[model samples]
Each structure stands twice: as structure tokens, then as C-alpha cells.
Target chain A: MSATEGFLHGLQLAFTPELLLTALIAAFVGTLIGVLPGLGAVAGAAIALPLTFMFDPVVGLVLIAGIYVGAQYGGSTGSILLNIPGDSTAVVATFDGYPMAQKGRAGPALAITAIGAFIASTIGLVFIVYSSGFVASFAITFNAVDYFALTAGGLLILARISGGTLAQGLLPMILGVVIATVGMESTSSYPRYTFGNLDLTLGIHIAVLAVGIYGVSEILYLIEDKRQRASYKKIRIKDLVPSRSEIRQSWGPWGRGSILGFILGTLPMPSATISTFVSYRMEKGIARNKSQFGKGAVQGLAGPEAANNSAAIGSIVPVLVLGLPFSAVLALMISAMIVHGIQPGPLMMEQQPDLFWSVIGALAIANVMLLVLNIPMIGIWVRILQIPRYILIPVIVLVASMGVFSVSNNMVNLYLMLALGAVGYFLRKYNYSLASMLVGFVLGPLIEDNFVRGMRVSQGDPAYFLSSTFAVVIWSVVVLIVIGAAVRTLLKRRAQRRLLDSTAK
Target chain B: MTLEPRTEHEAEPGGENLETPPEEHVEGRRSGSVVFATLSLVLAVGYVWMAFDMPNGTSGDPGPGTWPRVTGIAWVGISVLALIESLKVVRTAPADLFPTGKSLKLVAFFSAATVAYVILLPILGAYIVSSVYMFYVIGLLRSKWDIRGGIYAVVFGVGASLIFIELLQVRLVAFPW
Candidate 1:
């Protein structure tokens, strides 16, 4: 089928009562999870995975897809209102978002975020519709060497760009690789580091790790700082409507962010978090009023939020086409699809074009649903902050623990979550980048697999790594990015020292 | 609560009305850095030891240990550099690094409660264990006991069970309460 015909068919299928209803429910649940701190979309999908067991596979896929998109929209709410990120991508939003709230422009900040996200998601959907086939065909030609280089390039850039000293970032990243090696070794069927525990042999599930690190660790931090629990001013509906000037200023950032997000999100990288940071930096560099950033600039809010939503849509391309997931959330989405017997790959496009297109259509519809549901409901979401922290914290804990436990129905998961929660806490305390670690862990097995395969194909000749043009190009980019990051960090530190010296004088 | 629009000058970036203070450029204390360095070093050593125990086939036909051993050696080098850098730093206690006395006690209580909640979950079931855990956590956070807290705990516990069990149909291992 032609792309146009498939899109129309998918749209027709998406509008049916059952699928529309599923999308609506998933949107609500996704937004709810995003609004709540520590309960991310990964948990929502894991919790919802079993709920989809009885439904048609397409409906199940759509439901989880809706939830992922909704969470991306809802994530900015906490960042704008409470200075707490609803998720990691929202961390960039909090830089300017919370300051806007303090200045009584919280409504405009949030409104711009919604508008930017909706616009970007639309463009991202279009990008996927047009470019996914191209990417898939390109992926078909990729040898193991290309895959190895691509994965290594992603890890290197991620290590360089993640906030903190290079050593701090690389430590968590290397630790993640170590953690990923815990289960049976893929080549020889030999267990690497089970340490005699049967449960360890199965390896740590992503849900368990995410919930423990992102969810439980957040709770510990909040508990450690009671000041973070203070309530904010209740939001009014009038506060949500953006002024003409604010909306006009946001358009440029929105466009740039959408393009940036789509390009980055389609690549073999952790798109959502990385796109937001990169978009914010780009906006800051290009802004007419550069000083406004990190001080409640609407461009700061608009760009990152747009990138985040666009990246959410762009991330689906690889999963739908190449069957590779670049981030933790995408990994869970793949699992959800697999459980429903829908194997996502190039063959999926050929075998079930309707299903593939419908997934895309569902995401587009979900983006619309998010805009409609979130704008008028901003006041309600902000009111969530008014709930007493004492009451709110425990409910969050209960939900998080239950969600993790439900994934495998094992007590070991709960314990593992609590243990990793402690590890995550200390990691955060010492300024290690958890996202980098997570990227390392998620991409570890794939990297090892591709490398070993490439080597075996070349009869253990290391020279084969540089044999392919794609490998050479990818490695070149990796080297350039790492060097660029190091130079930038040195310049920034020197500038800071000069400022300090001038102040002293 | 009415929010008044600030003066235009105050709203401008880098103006006096900034909501939060500029980030202070405080250097980290030696103790914290030392702690992190030591932790990394110890972990790297253990990892290298484990890697050595596994078979290391020739470079031509690598075994399970190849990737890990390379990572472990690099990790050791990095940690030692971190250790050396940490030794040159002076001591200072930032708020995030060191909690207040009251917060310390709360941290202890929170940790203990979490451990207890995990251990008692299967034995008592999600419904009972969650309620009691919620009740205790709320009491500590609020620094007092109240009927409202108990009510909140009950609602959350029952709500979780209903959603996870009856609605979502997740098969959790729980006592038949």
C-alpha cells in the first residue's frame, strides 16, 4: 500500500469507538502518571500491559502509545508548577518553568509548553510517515560493523554531553555496562555475575530498575528535603491563556525544536532527554534576548517542551521500523508490543502495514487528545500540588511499589527496587548522571552483540571495525563530539575562573 | 490568593526580582569525593577479580570475560584519577551533601520503614501491608497521628488493590485477606 492509503486506513481504524475509547483512557492515565512525581509512563505502561492482554493487539499497542505521548505532555506540569521534574526530560523545563511560576506567569509558561508540544508532535508525526520507510531501507543495508559503530557513537556522545565532570558521567555509564553483564553471557551461555542467586540469572527487568532509580530514589530525595514539599498558589483558568506576545515569541523556538527533535529522535541516540537539552542550548544561543534563559524565558520553556514531545514521536520510528529501542520507555513499548505477538521490524511494515500505520495514527490522535485534555485541566493539575505532602508522598510510594511488583509478581523486584533506590540516591548525591547510566544499561547488550558479531564475521580482525564507510563516518562523528565537549567544558571553566578573579579584584 | 504582575523592569532577565538565587559555585568537600572515589575503586577491583575468574579466550575468539575485563581495567584507571583529584580538595559541607539533624532522623525512619514494608508485603498482603506502611509514613511526615491520616491510608491501600487486582487483573502474590 502507498503511504497515503495506509495513513487513511489507519486513521479510519483509529476513529472506531473501541480504539478511540482506548486512546482516551490511556491519555488520561498517561497524563495522570506524568502529573504525579516518581510515577513515570514506563510504570503506567507496565501496569497497563496486563490490562491489554485481553484486547486486540492493535488496541493494546495504541493504548500504550497513547500513554507514552500523554506522559510526555504531562511531564512539564510539575516542572512548571513545583520545580520538580515529572521525568528526566522535564528536568530542562524546570530551569525556566519554575521561575515563571514564581513570577506569576506559570500559566503562560505551561500554555506555551502545550502549544509547542502539540505543534512539534504534528511535525514529528509527519516526519515518521515520510521518513520511516527510508530509515528502514537504510537499516537493512547496515552490517554488524555499522551497528557497532552507531551504538558506540551514541554511548560516547551521551557520556560527553551528560551534565557533570566527564569522569562522573563515564563512571555511571561504565557501571551500567557492568550491571548489564550480570545475567548469562550471550555467546557461551555462561552466567557472568549471578553470584549463585537464581533470581539474578534472569537479569534485572527495566521496569524494576526504572521504578527503583527514578521513582523510589525521588521519594528518598523529597523526604530528605521537606522544603520541597511546600504548596504553590492555586492556578486559575485565566492564567492558562497565553498572551499574544508570548505566543508570537514562541513560534520560532517551536519550529526549531521540532526539527531538532525529529532529527535527533530518529537517530541511534537517547532522544527525549538529549533533544531537550540540545534544544535549550540552541535556543539560548540564537535568542535575541539570551539572558532571559534560566530566568523564566518562554523560549526556554517552549524549545525543550517541543523537543520533548517531538522526540516522543520521533522515537517511534526506530521501534516501528528497525525494531531497535533507544531509551528505557521505548524498550518497554517494544515489550508491550511483543507480548501482544506483534513483532516490530521491517517485515512488520510488509506483513501488517495497517497495524503499523494505525500505531502511527494512534500516536497522532493521542497528541491531539493531550492538547484538548490538558489546556482546560491545567488548573486542576496545579491544584494537585495543594494536597498535603504528608498525604501525597505515601500514596505515591504505594502506587510506585505496587506498579513495580505487578510487573513480575515477585518479591525480589520490590527488594531490588529499594536497593537500587539507595544506589540512585547516592549517585544523584555525588552528581553522577543517572540518564547516562540508564542509556548505557539499555544499550549495553546491543553494543556487545554487534561488536562480537562484527569481529566473528571478520575472523577476529580488529581492522574490520574501520572497514566500512558507515563505521568510519560514525566513529569520526563520535571522536569530534567527544573532543568538542571537552573543549567546551574547558572554556566554560576558564570563563568562570576569570569572572571569579574579576569579582575578587 | 491574588498574584500581582511584577514591574516590567523586575520581569526582565538578570534583574533584581529573580525568583531563585544564582547558583553558588561552591567546591565539594574532600570527604564526599573521597567516599565516591573509594566506592568506585572497590567496585572496580571486585569487577576485575570476577572478570579474571571467567575464561579469556584468545583475542581471535574472545570469551565471556573480554568486554568486562576491558571495562574493569579502564574503570580502575578512572577511579584512581578521581581518588587523586579528591585528595587535593578541601572540606566544605553543602546542604545537599549533608542533611540537617531533623532530616537525618527522618531519613533513618524512612529507610527502616521501606525495608519493613518490603519484608512484610508478601506475608500480610498488598492490602494490609500498604495501609499500615502508608499510615506510618504519613504519621512521620506530618509529625503526628490523626484520623485523617488513617483514612487516607485506607483509601490508597484499597484503591491500589482494586485497580491492580480487580480492574487491571494483575496476579500479585498476597495473603487471601
Candidate 2:
């Protein structure tokens, strides 16, 4: 089919009544998850994964994608109203958004955020349409060696940039890969880590692990923290419309942030969080009246909100094109696709163009739904903030347990989920990168398969890895990243030593 | 726009604004890192030993063990590094890392309760177990036990069971005929 025809078909598929209803429900749930503290996109999606299994692959994928976009839009509401960021990506919003609320301009701040997110998501969707085809086509030519380099190099870069020291990130990731090594090996059907147990040979499910790590662990953490209810004044519908001056102030930041976010989101980084910080910095650096920022500048609120949503949308391109998930949330999406027997890489466009285009169409539809839902339902979201932990926590626990149990109807999986949840809670307390661990778990098998295939093709010659220019370039980039990290660490330590010595004198 | 000075409550880019652990609990965190590193070191050694037991064929005909072997070796090296880094500044009594006794009790109670729920699920069925579990947890989480918690719990339990078992046909254990 022609590109235009595929695009049109996708829109048709997404516009069906059943699919539209799915998108609407997903949007509402996603926003609710995002507005609630202690639940981010990853946890939200993981918990919702089992529900999607009842539908066809296209509908399941659209549900996941809708949740993703809706969460990005909803995260700002908590930041604006309570000075509490719903997630890390919403932290920047709290800087100006909360201040605006304190000044009784919360309505305008939320309006601008919704408008910016809508525009930015639209831009991101356009880019996804144009760029995915080109990227996928190029990826279609990748050999096993190239694939290995890409996956390995991407994991390494993610480890380096995923925060904390390299070892901290790498450890959890390596452990995840080790976890993936269980059950039967694909090529030889050899069970490596089963240890003579029949159940062990079946391997761990990605959904089980995701729900355990993100959903169950989050519940434990929230229980320990005992999140207090936030007080919020009711927002009427009329109060939600932005004034002419506020609208004028937001346009420039929104455009710039959208572009910046899209570019960064395509890379293997925590793009949503990083893009917001970068956009905030850019706005601060370029603003004419700098003093207006912390006190409640529309530009400050608009830029980061735009960047957060755009980056969330833009991150999907890599997953669809290369089957490389750069974030934890996208990793879950890839897992869902795999569960549905849909391979998400370059060949997917040829094999499942309808699914691919329909996802894009779903995202656009979800974005519009968010814009429409968020403004009129501002009062409801605020009430959600007031929900007591006693009520919220139990509901989440029930849902998570039920979700995991329903997937396999096995008691063992529930036991495993509980154990993993305990482990995840500790890991999180120590600041380990769960995102890195999740991405590694998803990509580990792909890396091993590619490596083995490349080795077999090349008769075990190690030089074959460097034979291709793409592989060579990828390895070079990996080396550069390592060296850069080492140098930065050394310089930081040296600076610390100098300060200590001077203080001693 | 002037950049706002970061406050203590503000979350970092890749982190959240969790409450600070108590002064006594701070030492436990430090020692907890050491314990974790030691455990990881032991796990790595065991994994490496197991990896060697499997057949690792030559480069041309790599066995299922080849990737795990390489990963196991890398794991050993990284674990050693982690251990060293963790030990560099270890100072504190090896107490439990929970910030408060209340928090510890809450986590322990919930964990135990969940374990019990799982055990009872297949026997008593999902609806009965889930309702009781939710009711108990809600009462525990609330400052004082109330009838409202019971209502919410029953609604949630039956509502969830109906949606998953009836509407979605999820094949969950339901009421015994």
C-alpha cells in the first residue's frame, strides 16, 4: 500500500466506535494515574497491560499508546495545583505552575499546559509519520552484527546516562539480563537456569516482572510514605480558558520546546525528564524578563510542559522503527507487541502496516481526547488528588494482584511477584535505575541472538564485528561515552579533593 | 525568565522527592549498601560457576552457555567493583533500613497479609479472599476502623471479579459452584 493509503487506513481503524471507546477509557485512566502521586506512566501501563490482552493487537497497542500520551498531559495538573510533581518529568512544571496557583492564576497555567501539550503532541505525531518509514527502511538492511552493536551500544549509553554511577546502573541491568537467561534457550531449546524444576523451564513473563517491579513495588513504597492528601480549591470551567496575553506568551516556548524535545527523544536518554529540564533552561536563558520565571512566567510553564508531552510522543518512533525501547514505558509497549505475536522492528511496517499506522492515529485521537477531557474535568482531577491513601492503596493492590493472577492463573506467579516486589522496593530505595533494568530485560535476548548469529555467520572471527561500518561507528560511540563518563567522574573527584584540602587548611 | 533555585522539596530530573530517612536510619542505609554489595558478589560468583558448568562451544558454533558465560564474567568484575565502592565509606550499625518502626510494621503487615491472601486465593476463591483482603488492608491503612472501609472493599471485590471473570472472561478463580 502507498504511504497515504496506509495512513488513511490507520485513521479508519482508529476511528471505529470500539477503538474510540477504548482510547477514551485509556485516556481517562491514564490521566487518573498521572494525576495521582507515586504512579507514573510505567506503573500505570504495567498494571493496565492485562486488560489489553482481551483485545486484538491493534486495539491493545492503541490502549497502551493512549495511556502513554494521556499520562504526559495529566502529570502537569498535580504539579500546578499542589506543588507536588506527579512524576519526575513534571518537576519543572512545579517551578512556575505552583507559583501561578499561589498567585491565583492556576487556571491560566493549566490551560496553557494543555494547549502546549496538544500542539506539541501534534507536531510529534507528524514527525513520527514521516520519520518512522525512513528509519524502518534503513533498519531493514541491518545484519546481525549491526543489530548486536546497536542493542549493546544502546544499553551501554542508557546505563551511562540513566543517572548514578555506571556500576549502579549496569548492575541492575546485568541482573535483568541474567533473569532473562532463564527458561529454554531459543536456538537449542536448552534450559540454562531451570535447576531441574518443571515450572522454571517456562521462564518468567515480562508482564509479571513489570507489574512486580513498577506496580507492586510502587504500592509498597507508597504504603511506607503514607502520602498525605493535598488540599485544592475547585476550578470552574470558565476559569480554565487562557487569556490573550497568556496565550501569546506560550506560543514561542511551545514551538521551540517541541523541536528540542523531538530531537532529544529520538536518542537513548531519559528524554521526557531531560527535555523538560533543557527546555526550562533554554527558556530561562532566552527570556527578556527573567525575573518573571519563578514568580509564574507563562513561558516557563509552557515550555517544559510542551517538551514533556512531545518527548513522550517522540520516544515511540524508536520503538516502532528499530524495536529498540529507550525508556521503561516503551519497553512495556514492546513487550505487549511481542506477547501479541507482532514483531516491532523494521519488517513490521511491511508485515503489519495497519497496526503501525493505527497506533499513530490512536495517539492523535488520544491527544485530542486529553485536551477535551482535561479542561472540563479539572474539578474531578482535583478531587482525585484528595483521595485518601487508605482507599487508593488497597484498590491498586487488588488490581495488581488480580491482573497478574489472571494472566496465567498460577499461584506461583503471585509468589514470584511478591518476592520481586520486595526486591524492587529495596533496589529503588538505593536509587538503582529500574528503567535501565527493564530495558535490559527486554533487549537481552535480542542481543544474545544477534551475537550468536553474527558469530556463526562469520565462522567465529571476532573481526567480523568491526567489518561493517555501522558496527564500527556504534562501537566507537560506545567507547567515547565510556571515556567521557570516566573523565567527568575523575574531574568531579578532583574538584571535591581540592575543596576538602582548602577547608582543612 | 530567571531559573528558580531548587528547593529541598523539588525533585531532581531523574529522581523523586522522597522524604529523608531519619538520622539513625541513615547509618542503616550505608550498611545496607554494603550488605547488598556482598550479596551481589556472592550471586555473581555462583552465576559464574554455573555458567562454566554449561557447554560453551567455539566462536563459530556458540552454545547456549556462551552469552551467559560472558555475562557472568562481566558480572563478577562489576560486583567486585560495587563491593569496593560500597565498603569505601561504610560507617554505621547494620540495622534494618526502614525509616521508622511504624513504617516497618506497615510494610511487614501488608507483606504478610498479601502472602496469606495468595495462599487462600485458590482455596477460598478470588471474590471471598479479595474482599476480606481489601477490607483488612483498608482498615489497617485508615486511622481507625470504619464501616465505610467495608463497603468500599465489598464493592471493589465484587466489581473487580465481575469485570475480569464475567465481562472479560479472564479465567480467574471464582465462587465455587
* TM-score for chain B of all predictions: 0.77, 0.78
TM-score of each: 0.85, 0.95
Each candidate's fnat: 0.45, 0.56
Docking class of 1: acceptable
Q: Each candidate's lDDT (Cα)?
A: 0.76, 0.83
Local lDDT at A420 for model 2: 82
- For model 2, state the Cα shift of residue A478 in Å: 1.8
> A135, model 1: CA deviation in Å?
1.1
DockQ list for all candidates: 0.32, 0.43
Candidate 1 residue runs with Cα over 4 Å from true position: A16-18, A37-65, A78-109, A228-249, A267-304, A323-325, A334-348, A351-355, A487-505, B1-28, B84-94, B166-171
lDDT for each residue of candidate 2 in A208-231, tens digit (9 for 90 to 100): 888888888888777876345667
Q: What would the per-residue lDDT of candidate 1 be over residues B121-155, giving only the tens digit for each residue?
A: 88888788888988899999989878998998888
The alpha-carbon deviation from the true structure for residue A229 of candidate 2, after best TM-score superposition, in angstroms, is 1.4
For model 1, the local distance difference test gives 0.76
TM-score for the A-chain in each candidate structure: 0.84, 0.98
